[model samples]
Target: MSIHFTVSGLTRNLFHSLGLDNQRAPRPLNPEQSLLLECYLAGQIPESAWNDYVFETPELARHVNARRSQH
Candidate 1:
């Protein structure tokens, strides 16, 4: 007999066995991060400062890049 599991099911099973199925997902941007992103998008924040901020938190970089792509 052959057994089949979908890719997602296999991933889920792996995570469950590793006790990582309950790990929290990435959160939405908080108000402060939103405001900073807005300012950066609006050209209010200098690129140097924005680069520094994004470098400090790669998650913020992802958020900013996603927002930029939407526009």
Candidate 2:
């Protein structure tokens, strides 16, 4: 999903190749991935570990990173 979103310069090129509009969202990407993708695309995360976290062990990553309820 993220791959579909953050791939290197492939977005516009492929869109053009397939005769897709630059104005429209690409069909290859899902709605969920679009958020992180936009952030990544806009260079918000300078020291990004998003790729490793998601690809390596998403469940463990989420478990460790999940917010605990404060009492």
Q: Which candidate is the best by TM-score?
A: 1
Worst window of 10 by summed lDDT in candidate 1: 18-27
lDDT, candidates in the order shown: 0.75, 0.47
Cα lDDT tens digits, model 1, 32-70, are 888998898889999899889977764676666566666
Error of 2 at 21 (Å): 25
lDDT of 1 at 33: 84
**lDDT tens digits, residue span 1-71, model 2:** 35445564777778757645334432443455556545654677443566664565343223223322211
Cα TM-score per model? 0.57, 0.30
Best by lDDT: 1
Query: Could you list the CA RMSD of all candidates, in the order they appear?
Result: 9.6, 14.9
Regions of candidate 2 where Cα sits further than 4 Å from its true position: 1-27, 53-71
